[model samples]
Every structure is written in structure tokens, then in C-alpha cells.
Target chain A: MQRPVPRRSGGGLARGIPAVLSVVSAFVIWEIYVRVSGISPLMLPAPSRVLDQMVQNRVLLWDNTVPTLKATFAGFALSLTVAFGLSIILDFMPRVRRALFPIFVVSQTLPLVAIAPLVVLWFGFDLTPKVLLVALVTFFPMLVALVDGYASTDPEIEDLMRSMGATRDQIFRAARFPSAMPYFFAGLRISITYAVVAAIFAEYVGARAGLGIVILNAKNSFRPDIVLAAVVISSLLTLILFSATALLQRTVLRWRDVEGHR
Target chain B: MTALSLKDVSVTFGDIPVLDRINLHVEQGEFVSILGPSGAGKSTIFRLLTGALPLQTGTISCASPENSFAFMPQRDALMPWRRIIDNLTLGLEVQGIPRKDARAHVAPLLRDFGLADFTTHYPAQLSGGMRQRAALLRTIVQGRSIQLLDEPFGALDALTRTQMQTWFEDRWRAARWTSLLVTHDVREAVALSDRIYVLSRRPARVIAEITVPIPRPRLGRPPSAQAHDIEAHLLEILLHQTGEKP
Candidate 1:
């Protein structure tokens, strides 16, 4: 007897309703808090003022945002490539994986904030530091995802492929690599959110131009309106990148179960 | 022609002895089954033959060309991300056949496998029976002369298992590729196998091997009375292997 898998109806959009509502309500409450508190704009500018600053300083915001975006994209690309290459190599060389995996874990313990300054000190106030820091921070999660994904491969499938006269590389291509796709995408979602934040922090340490610089200047000048405006813009950038990754996962792994699509 | 033979073969896993000795043969185009209770080390034999496990002591001789044997594990083992057609063509594609050529090669057989309309569907979208059928097609599509199936329908419910046995019987009769099946189902063994090897429990050895004299299509399609007798005989031995009263 085939037991029908119980599926939640109305699709992913239905499930996402509460999240949308919570965000909207949070924004509305923020707008009200600013209006009623009558706080100093320096201490707490009204959400409306923040919105107005976003528009008023759009040109300035855009120029700074471009550099941060460039750093994020560049860093994310470098991180993903490095992670993929390393995961594949480690998967092939078990001796190397066993030796290096503990070192990688130890490396994660080195504080990103402390390392950011050192990276800047070494590379100077330019794009290089930002890119290296972002890649340094983001590559680990994807690498972990890939290593765990390779491990998650069903041993039966490996045996099946081996029985077919497939080479080690062929077994990986047909079974192990495809088996890791879901995990890899999950790692991508997590890493993409970190991309913008890491870029901003790196720039905060040192940069010629970026959102981090703009936010620091605004904070120094007591322009909370501009600072909050930059915060909103940076958040929006992270949100957009995250959503794109999710969309790409849905497209690439559309063959997965309906429940996974959500 | 003798396509495969295992002579004085025995397997042990570290301290555990799984197969004491197994001497079996599968002639060209013959359908044979190795039957026993669960954990009878039936699969160990296949694993040894496929080089998945080291042969502790004994010899396995097979003159079948490289890539001439397809081994199907118990689970469907389909790549969840691949479409049904891609999953079916996995063996061929991995053997250096390009995807387009593999797809083309299996296209005509999809209709026979009842998966023509499911080319684009994923494994999760298909029913359990359909997925198992797809897996079987994947095995057959390897174009292998010898196919090793390890309890292919063991996970199915009773009714589906019965139906699949009948369906598999029809397909096997049509092509009659040299196949060695490992199953614990007595009726299944009686219905499908030309000759059967009954194995004892862990540290298993071939206790008995019987040739079915019952006629063809001895399944849901009104199997002969003799088929029932053979099933009963096999079931009793299998139950006895597990030290149970039959």
C-alpha cells in the first residue's frame, strides 16, 4: 500500500505570510515610536526622517553602495570558487582531509573583527582588504557545507556506480556531487547574508569608499538619520542577495520534493 | 556457457564470519536466485562478486566483459535532483556515454518500462512502485548481460510486492538476460527463479539448490498447484534457517 506523503497545502507563499506580516508590523511600530517619543534626531530620528534622508542623500548613498556591492560580489565569487575547489580536493584526498579539517576548525576561532584590522593593516585602505576579509569569513561555511555534503552521499549509490565500471571521478560526478547540491545551496543562502555584512565590516576597518565609511561619517557628524538610512540600505542589499540565492536554489533543485521548495 | 561461478567462496568481516562457503553458478541467460532469511549474508555474496567487499577466502570467476554486469541495491538510490530519465540513464552515462546518447538509447525502453510519460518527473513525484520500476529500468538499461538484484521489491507492501513479482517475471521471460536475484520471499523465488540456492543464516552456506519444474507465469496469473508446493518447501527451509517453526 502506497502511503501518500502528507503535504502542507497552499505552497510556499502561504507559509511566508506570517513573516511578511511580522516585518510590516515591526516597521509600523518603529514609525510610531519615533513620532510619539519626540526624541532628538541625533539620538533617534523618526523612521520617516530616515526614509527622507535615504532619498535626499540618494546620490551619495548610491556612490558608496557601489563600492560595497562590488566588494560583496567579488568576495562571494572568490569564496565560492575556493570552497568548491578545496571541497573537491579534500574529498579526493582523504588523508589531506583528515589532516586539514582540524586546522580549518581552529582557523574559525580566530576572531573576524581582529583579523579584519590586520588584513587592512597589511593590504592598506583599498578594495583588496575588503575582498580578502569577506572571502576569508564566508568561504568556511560553504566549505563545511561541501565537506558534509560529500559525506552525506549514500554509500549504496557509490557502490552502484562502482559496479558500473565508473572511475572515482565519474562516481563523484554522477553521485557524490549531485547528492551535495541541496547542502551546497543551503550553504550559499547562509554565506550570501554574511557577504554584505563582512564587506561592510572590512570597510569599517579601512576603505577608500563604501557604505561602512558613509555610516561612520554620519555617526561622527551626529547625523543619525543618515546612519539609519545607510543601515536600511545595507539591510536591503543583504535581503536582495539572499532572495536571489534562494531563487537560484529553487530553480536548480526544482526536482526536489514539494516540501523542500518552501 | 557458464557466465559466472563462485567456487569455495567464503567471506568474513573482521571477527564475524558471514559466509562459510558458497559454490554457485549462473549459466548464460539463466535466471537464478539465492534465497534465505534476512541477514543471511546473501548480499555479502554480491558485494564480494562486485568487489565491494574483499573476498576473505575463495575464488570468483567471471568471464563477462567489463561493464557487462549491473548491480541494483535494495533502495531505488535515484539521485533526488535528477529527472526520471536521467536517473534511468545514470549507469550508461557514467560509463562514458554522453547524456544525449544515453537518453536516446533509453528512449525506446521507457515505454516498455511504463516511464515514457515520466521523463521529466523526479523520483519523489513518482509512486514507490514507479520509482522501483525506474530503478529496475536503470539496471537493465546498462545493457549488461548479467544483472544482480538484491531484494528489489523487499520494501514494498505485500500487494505491490506481489504485482511487481508478476511484472518482473513477464519482463524477465521476454528478455531472459542472465540474472541472479537475492530474495527471501519463498513464493517470489518459486515464481521467478529457474534454479534456487537456499542459504543458511549468518556465516551462511548454500544448504539447498532446487530447480523449479513449475510452468511459466506461475504467479498472480493462476500459478500451478506445484508452484505452491515448492514455495511451501522453500519457506520451511528458510524458517528453519532462522530456527523458527514453519
Candidate 2:
């Protein structure tokens, strides 16, 4: 999509070519190394073999991808909404922020490996557990970014707004919120990548359909190529989510970029 | 006609007293300045006038309330994210005026302030002088009769500050709003203000109030003899307040 294009002219192709070339070169070396070294396909699949398996099982891969994508988007959306709402409440009420902030930190300290299975046991094998896992993993960064953004707002601007008869809500809307936007996007980028990983991990523990299930099935059948194929798909999904966040950041925070040039 | 008055005002932040029994007033259609050394609580007086700092012990009576006055602090304080015109109309927007109407209202005044072509430009694009001019235009467009400026030109380069001083003086002569300026610069206070009040160090109290003996249209090379005399007198008072030999 045109939306994916980098904002600067000519620089996009100049910057993108090197990165694309490096990945392609890595795959080429890997393909050649595996073939010449006489390594067993069971241990490490050759790049070409993985590509072949991917084409043969395209329908299966696509079917698995659909469920993972759905879970990730649903969980990411839930996390974003909840984080935004909580950050706003914490910004206005410092006492509440103080009381709840440590609890949020403690929540993050609980390993997902220990908690994901419990979440699955409680929610059954439905999408609920996967979604909750993603939410739990992604919410903290977004909340911290927003709270920090709101707190770091320039006091002079706030004072100007207040002197102009702006109410507390007006100051928050005009000054605090806009200043917090860049930070929010920073958090969103982090959470987005985590959301995808969390969704797959949740599925690995318990899910009827998804790339995690495909990987598990391939591993049991000793189809290393098929597992690698699913790994490639997951990697692509993470890249897409990451790039989309960068594009959104560029669009919304254009002023910051303009200021830098000047 | 006196526009505003603060009688026997005293302010303390925790146990530290900022302004002690301060008394000052500005007349209608006059430019008044408060001159003091740095950290003499000059800005605290402004904060009090704007109602940003609550009145500790004082009687501050303005012809208009705090909200009805335009206040410009030392910093330009323009919203970097907003275009020049949008930042100018922000106050109007806060007052329940529609954005379109507020933009329209400021559109004509932009030419007067030399910012007609830069309406869409962000604050970062402007020079120091241009930013201060935009800030001043933003304040003036509020249509408030009382203006409280706290060292508005203190951030600019010396050349820019001088240019801004002349520019502001020309405008003030044409449209005399009841203006109160707080600055540590003696020349700035002398060049622009009709009356100047010199304040002492911490727990600031007015030590001298000198009315400019020079007549209006006080601009150009080699100021009047009276202007020179007043500047010397104020400088001496400031030196005395700071316990420095001049």
C-alpha cells in the first residue's frame, strides 16, 4: 500500500535497498552452506527446502496465519484501549497512580511461561486466553509511555493555557494530550511486536488453529522445513506490525521531524 | 485613571517570603515597568497578577479580573505542534470561540505583525524575534486592556532585543493598553516604560518609583537628557538595592 512508503523522497529506495540486500544475501549463504555441508535436513532445513515446503503447504500456512492474525489484532486492540484509559486516570490522580503503578510493575514480573497455561486452563481452548495473554504482555509499556508523556509536558505552555482562562480539562486536551502523542506511539510500537509474540505463545500452549499449532505438528512429524516455513510467516507478521507502527509514527509526528531539520 | 493596584501585598512559598508588603499600580493608557535584579521576585508579582499564584496577603484590584488581562511570560511559550496562526487563536478557542472564526479574526492582524506569509509555519521555523513578535500578536489579539509582560525580550539576542524594544515602543505609542513589564534590563525598562519601579533583593519591596520626565515618542539615537538622567537614577537605585557600589 502507498501508506507503507517512507515520507522522504528518494531516501526510501536508497535506505531500503541495503537492508533488503543483506537479508537476501544471508538466505543465499544459508542455502549454499546447508547443501555443501551435507547437513541432515531433519536438524536444519535448507532455505530452498523451506521455500518448497511453504509453496506446497500454502493453503495450510494461510489457514494457520488467519487465526494468529485475528488473535493478535484483538489482543492488541484490547490492550491499547485499556492502557489509554488507565493512563488518563493516572495522569489526573497522582495518588491513584502511586498506588497502582507498583502493582503494574509486579504484574510484568510474573513470567508469561508460568501464567499462560493458567490463563488457558481458566478460559478454556477458546480465543479468550490468547487475547488475555497478549493484553497482559503489551499493556504496561503503553501505560508508562502515556503517563511519562503527560508528566513531561512543558509547564510554560500549561501556564499560558491557564492564564488564558483554560480549565484543567482544556489544558489536558490542548497541551498534555498532544505532547503525550509521540510517547504513546513509541509505546505502541513496542507493544505491537510483543502482542504478536504473546499471541503465538498463547496458541503454542493451547489453541485449535494457528501457526503455533502448525509448528507443533511439524516438529512431531520431524518436518523441520514446515516448522521453518511457519517461523518465516511469524517473522513476516512481526515485520509488518513494526513497519506499520513506523509509518503511523511518521504521519502523526511530522512536526517533530520538521523541527529537527530546522 | 488607575487601571490596577496591588496594595500591601505579601507572598510566601512555604516559609520563604517572595514579595513583602509590595505596593504598585499602573495607570490606564500607560506603560509601567518593574525593574529589579534577577531572583528579586519580579515574576512572582506577575504570577500573583495572573492568579497563577494565590494571593497570600494583599489587596489586588484590577479594573478587570485576572482572566481579562493578557499575560506574556519570559518564554515565547508557543505550541510547537501548532502553526503560527493556530497558536495565536488558541486563547480564543479556549474561550469557546469557534476555530474558524478565531482564525479569521487573527488573519488580518498577522500582516500588521509581519507574519502574514508565515501563518502556516510552525514556531520552530521562526527566528527569535519573529517568535516573540508572534507571541506579542497572540497576546494583543485577545483584546484585553491590561497586559502583564514578564521579561518578554529577555531571551532574544541583544540586537533582536533592541529591535523588538523599538518595535514594541512604536506600537504602544499608537495603542496605549495598560501594560506592566517586569525586567532586569535597566535600558529596556527605561526605553519603554512611562514609569519604572525598582525593587530590592529577596523579599522584594519597591525602593524607587520614577516617572519618565521625557515626553512621548521616546525613540531614536541619543535619547533625551531627561531619559539619560532617569536611566542613571534607576541604575543607581538598583545598585543600592543589590548592595553593589556603582
Candidate 3:
């Protein structure tokens, strides 16, 4: 007998309450720890001090954030375009897939920190190197996801299509691409976070502006509050990117329910 | 004219033969069943007919071109992402049939197949029986002259399978398309087929060809003694082929 599937309600507060409380609790603990320990504000500032630093330097924070955001978005767009094109090429040609798959695996092994300085020097600390670094880090996951998705398509379905007189291009458009979507979304979610981190790391090596530069300068000047504020902003950026990807996934794959449960 | 002809057809994977020197002729609009136990290479016959696997030896000929043949697999092969209407029109779409025209063609079929209400629902949202119906709808909309079904209803329960068999008979009689079904169920083959071909185990060879004398829509009504006698005879033949004593 088929069990009844439960209808989901889009109750925002029901889902948000727990997450909001967790953040609140963490802040409360941080406030208590700083006050009770009597730690110097320079070494470990209170959450309030971080908030004050954010408000006072809001203009500076915004100015630095724009460059990092620009690099991350540019890199992400370039990576997606190249990765998607490469996946299509590889999917059609098995020999190319076999030849390039090993190269992709080896490329991931190159150390980011060691390569970042050379990239900065080569590109002269401009937006180009930071974008390239981010693209390098983000491309592999999307490529791998697409390949696995293409491979995992059901052979039975493909055979049925062939029997129906569908050409190879038609089979791919109707069946193979749609089946690979969930996997592509999963890879995108992972890569979005990595894109932001890669951009920041590149900025840390050498950048005239960006949050990473602020953090490094604050650490040298012994201003822990400014460093914490920068960290918080970066985390917020990561959260925003992740949530957007998730929303896109839900909208695109609205037809498919998550398996085995509501 | 003969719809399908297999002359000395043989299939092998490496050294082991799956089908050996099989010969048969299916008349146009006739419903035939290739009945056998598992590993009898009944499915290999369907694959060969559909050109999914290459013919190793001898001549395997279809009166129609590749596009004129439609295949239904043992399991529901519906795309989970597509709705029933879109799924049914997949064959048409792949043939470069315009989406507007395909939808128009499939609209009447949705109502005919009792799937009008569920046309917008995805395959995952459907029951097993409903999925099978949707699959048949897709196959029928392909408008092929020959349908190759490999145990299409084997996965359904006893009750659903019976209903599907009756539904299939009604559709087959109405559509008048030639069909070659591969099945292990002796009673099912005897009930639905005009003629049943029994295959021997492993390197499968045609052992017997028995004509089913029962009329269309056989089941629900009490079985006549003649139907019972024919069923017993077919069963005995199958048992002997599998080396079982009656």
C-alpha cells in the first residue's frame, strides 16, 4: 500500500526560531566570557566592542568588501561557464574525458597558499589574480558533479528513448540533463563557499583593498575587534551565497520531492 | 505481410551463447509471447528485435524501419522530473516533433488512458500501477507498428497485473499493432497471446509454439475447461523444457 505524502507548510518562523535562538545564545556566551575573564580588549574584545567597531568603520568596511565581492563573483561566473562547456565536450567524447580527468585530479593537488604569492606577483596584485585563484578552486567540483550526473543516468530510460526513435541530442536534453540537476546544485553549493574563501586567501597574500586586507592589518595593529568584525562579515557572505543556491535549487526542482521522507 | 521475421538468429556474449539459432515469424497485428523461465534469453529476443543489441549471426529482419518499433521495459522507465504529458510526448519530442503538436496529440491519449487527472503529476508521485499505465501511454503515443514488451507488467501485484492484462488486451485489440511480449508467467501468456513460443534454458532455443484458443479479455469470468486444459498443456511443456517431471 502507498503511504500518504505529507504536505509541507511554508511557515517561516517555525524554521527560523531555532536558528535565531542558537545565534543569540552564542552571543550571550561570548559576552559573558569576555566580561568574566577580564581579558584585554586588544587581545579578545567583547561582542559589543566588535559591533561598535563595525558601526564606526562602516564606510571603510563597505569599501574593502566591494573588491573581494567583485573578484568572487567574476571568478564564480567564469568557473561555471568554463566548467559547463568542458562537461558538455567531455560527455560527448569519451577519449577526451579519459585524458582530461586525470589532469583535473592533479590540478586540485596544487597548494593554494604556495601558488597565491606567485599568482599575485605575476598579476601585480590586481583583480585578475584573485579571480583566477577563485576559479581554479571552484571549477573541479562542478566538473566532477556534471560527469557523475551524466554517468548515473538510467540505461533503461536511454534504451526506451532510442527505441522511440529519439536521436542522441534529444535523449540528452529530455532525460540526461534533467537527471543531473540535483547533483549540479549540490556541487554549486560547495563551490560557492569555496569561491568566497579562495578570494579572501588571495587577498591575504597581497591586496590593496578587501576584507582579507583589513583582517591582516587589524591583526598586526593588535585590533581584535576589527578582525572579529571582518570574520563575521565573511561568514554572513558565505551564508547568503549558500541560501541563494538552495533557493534556486528548490525553485528549479520543485517537481521532485526529497526521497524517503517529507 | 509478416511484421517481423527472425531467421537462424543467434546472440552470444564472448564465448557463451545467449540465444541460439532462433527462427520465428510474427504476422502483422498479432500478439505473440516468448514464454520462458529466467535466463532463457527471452529478454535477449526483445533486445535483438529492438536493435538494442546487435544480431551476432543470421538474418533478423523487421518489415519497418528502426523508428517504427517501440519498446516497453520490464520496469517503469518514466523520467521522474517530467509530468505524464511530457513523458508521453518524449518520443515525439526526440523526433523533433514540435512541442505544441505533441501536446495536442497527447491530450486525447491522456483521457483515453485514464491519466487525464494525473497528467501534471511527476512519475515519483504515481503508484506502481499508474506508472505502468503512463508507460503504456508513452509507448502507444509513439505510433509505432510493432511494440516489444519485456515483462511490462511483471512488477505489478496479482490484482493490478490482471487489470493491466485486460487493459492491454482491450488496447491491443483496438490499436491492432503487432506485439511481441516476453514473459515468465504461463497463464498470462496463454490468456493474452494469440500464440506462445516456449524457449529452452540458457543458450535459448525455441522448444514449442502453442496457439492460445481463448478469446480476448480472458479472466474475471470463470475459466472454461478448454482454457484450463490448454494452460495445463503449456505448463507441462514448460516444465519439461526446464527438466521438471509433470
Candidate 4:
């Protein structure tokens, strides 16, 4: 019989085991504290109760999660497209890079909470406002990473290219773009996590569906376990998105390891 | 025919002239080494020849029929993202040579340079000697007749540098291309070149053109005292140029 390949456990799971244990321990403590302290179920539910609620309202939870996932994915896609396009434009033009960099920085400073309502008012409670909010939150980091990557091109390598009669476009394609992959992936990882949070925040302000809406409905109905379930689901979603970005990074940057230097 | 000619060539960075009204010529297939101390403007000559720097005054031109030139800078300017083969084909690719065609030419060259296994490896993965060899291969693969090398093996260790010197000599002997190398190591210049040009410091000018009577394949120990004497003479001129000697 052929021997099966020994499967390597993902570092993420190994690293996460202790964290999961700590969180479960903390939740157990919270459950005990709530029970002993005479806190009403409406005020705070135990971890067991939250798990029970999640099981009971699995379909309802899925329905709410769908909207949030839709908004997050849509907004993230838009943000990625916009950030990538803007980075390329800025990279091509030094004057544009210098002129727009401050504007991009200023965009990040505009508090999303303040802008969320305004976006809702302007674009209404539809998907447009939610996407705008997520895009606004996620764009800066990607843009900055791309710019840094472009700037990080080794000058000596660039000189070599020039001496070889490489045109500017040739140099960028051969060196600058490849060199920037790590930085770009790093930015994407950061922004993807933020995408989920931004979408949730936007949904919290005004939304017909989404985990945010589910949490708000649970809170209004005095169902603390339902609220906790929604929170857990959202956290899981964020983790999934983060893991996916990491996977993408590994695939794209596999050549970097082969190159010897990071 | 002269491969390269610099007639009254002067290069000034702002008010300071790094190479002042320098005149030199390298005949076709001749190996000439520019020997001087650090900051002797030996590198500046290579830079000017390679069009990295513009001549401030006078004409500097290559007279070779092939006219094209390749520069091997002091640092191994290999792109970390590119594989060894891709790095070697970079010049050809840039010059509008199709990837398939470029690879066809570069594949054999990599094998010849003992870098066939490393074709898929990145520059970061290679050792100092390997990187230098890869860089040289890249320069040669460009199909340039004139090679302007500025301390191509300067960053390598003594052992690796010696190894590279032998590799370079063997390759150059086979290729029979005109090469002008700028180096601080006297023995390296003496071992590799037919003639050596000694330059003065700062506002550098040719102090002497010392003929290296030493035969090829200068292996084993270092050269004799007579070789050191010529090196000392060149060093003395360099030190005097820098005003280190009265």
C-alpha cells in the first residue's frame, strides 16, 4: 500500500489553538460571572446560551450574514479596483503622486462614522452607501503599499536595466511590478479585514439586511444570545477573509522565497 | 580599429571636474584595465562610456563596428524578482527580442557559466560569486561587442574574486570581445588586461599606461615583486594625485 503524504497543519490553526482556548476560557468566566452576579439574560447571555441561540436561529443568522457578505465583497472589490487603478496612475506620474498623496491621507482622516450617515443620506439605505463607506475605509492602505513598493525598487537593479537599454515600461514590468508584489499583498491583507468591519459599521447605521441589522434587531427584541451569535458570525467572516488574503499572498509571492531575499 | 575613443573628454559634477580633458583609446579586441585608488575617477570613465554620465566637453565615442556596449557595474544589479535566465535575457527582452528567442540564446550561456541549475532561482538565492557570474552572463547575452566593466568582482571575497578572474579570462579569451575594466586590484588588472591606465585622483587624468608583460592564466600565488613594483609605481602616482604624498 502507498503511504499517504503527511499533512502539515496550518500555522494559523496551531497559533490559533491557544487563542481559541483563551477566548473560550474567558467566555466561561463571563458565563459564571453573569450567572453569579444576577445579571438578567436580556442584559448578557452565557456562551452556552449564545451557542444554543446560534443553533436555533441558524437559518436566520445565515440570511443576515448573506447581506453583510454581499456588501463586504462588493465594497472590497470596488476599493481594490479603485486603489489599484489610482496606484498605477500615481506610479506613472510623479506630479500626480505628490499632488494626490495628501488628498488620500486626508480621506483617511474623515471619520467613517460621520461619513456613514452622510453617505446613507446621500445615496440612501441601499448598497451604494455601504460600498462607498467600505471603499473609503479600505483604499488608503492599498494605495500606500503600492507606492512604497514602487519606491522600494533597488536602484542598482534599475541602473542595470537602464544600461541594458530597457525602456521605462520594460523596467517597470520586469522589476518594479514584481518587486511590489509583497507590499501589495500586505496592503490587501490589512484592507480585507477592514472591509468586513467597515461593511458592518455601515450596516449598523442603516440597513435592511446584514449581521449589523440582525444584531440591532436582536438587541431591540432583548435577545442577547442572538446578538452574540451575530457578533461571532461576523468575527468568523473576518477570519475567513484574512485567511484567504494570506493564501493569495503565499501563492503570488512564492517566487520571492525562491529569489533568496525577501 | 579602435573600439572606444575618449578625446579631450571632461566630466564635471557642478564646478568640480571628476575627469578632466582625458584622452584614451582601446583598439578592437584589446583588454585595457583602468587602475587607480578609490575616487580616482576610473569608474567615471566607464560611466561616461556607458552613457551613465554625459561628457561635459569634447567627444567620447566607440569606433567598434558593433558599436553596442554592455556595462557590468560594481554591484550585482540583479533583480530579486527575476529568475537567473530572465535576468540574463533582460537586455535582449528590452531590445525587442522575443522571450522565446532570448531564452534560446541565454539557455546555452547559463549552462556555459555553470548557472543552468540556477536559471529558475532568484538573485537573492545566489551566492556572491554566482550572482557576479550571472550578471556577467546578462551583460554578455546582450550581444554587445564592447564590455565596460567597473569592478564586476569587487564585492566578492579574495578567493571568489580570484576564481571569477579566471572565469572572466577564460570567457574573454573565448569571446575575444574588446573590454575596458576599471579596478583597484593591481593584480586583477595585470592578470586580465594587455594594458593598464593609471589615473590621478579627483579631476582625474591618465598618469601612465603600464603594459602588463605577465602572461595569461596567472594562477597559484600572487605575482612577483616586479609586478608589485609596477603596481607600487601606479600606487605612488595615485597617492600623489590624492595629495597623500609630498
Assess each prediction's global lDDT (C-alpha) against the native: 0.87, 0.88, 0.86, 0.83
| Tens digits of per-residue lDDT for model 1, B95-201 | 77898999999998888778898888778877878889999999999988889999999988888888888888888889998999999888788888999999988
lDDT of 2 by residue, B99-217 (tens): 99999899887877889988887787788898999999888888887988989999998988888888888888877878999999988888888888999998898988888867766
Better of 2 and 3 by DockQ: 3
**What's the C-alpha lDDT at position A39 in model 4?**
83
Clashes of each: 0, 0, 0, 1
Q: What lDDT is reached at residue B172 by model 3?
A: 73
For all predicted structures, in order, the TM-scores are 0.94, 0.96, 0.96, 0.92
Query: For candidate 3, lDDT tens digit of each residue in B1-246?
Result: 898888999999999988889988788989898998888899888777677888789897778855667888989899888877888888888777898999898997776677888877777777888899889888878888888888999999999998888877777777777888899998888888899888988888899888887776676677778788988988888788778531
Encode model 1's per-residue lDDT on A203-233: one tens digit a residue.
9888889999998899899898998999999
Runs of candidate 2 with Cα error greater than 4 angstroms are A1-10, B244-246
Tell me chain A's TM-score in each of the predictions: 0.93, 0.94, 0.94, 0.90
- Runs in model 3 deviating more than 4 A are A1-5, A9-12, A258-262, B244-246
Once model 4 is optimally superposed onto the true structure by TM-score, how far is the C-alpha of residue B155 displaced, in angstroms?
Answer: 1.0
Scoring the B chain of model 4 against the true B chain gives a TM-score of 0.92
Native contact fraction, candidates in order? 0.60, 0.54, 0.58, 0.58
Report model 2's TM-score to 2 decimal places. 0.96
lDDT (Cα, tens digit) per residue for candidate 3, span A1-262: 2324446766878989999999999999999999999999988899999999999999999999999999999999999999999998898899999999999999899999899999999998889999999999999999999888888899999988877766778777877888888889989999999998999999999999998999999999999899999998999899999999988988888776623322
TM-score for predicted model 4 compared with the true structure? 0.92
Question: Candidate 4's residue-wise lDDT over A1-262, tens digit each?
Answer: 1122233346757878998899889988998998899888888888888999899999999998998999999988898898888888888899998988999999999988788989999998888998988899988998899889988998777777777777788888888888788899989989988998899889989989889898888889888889899989999999999989888887778766453333
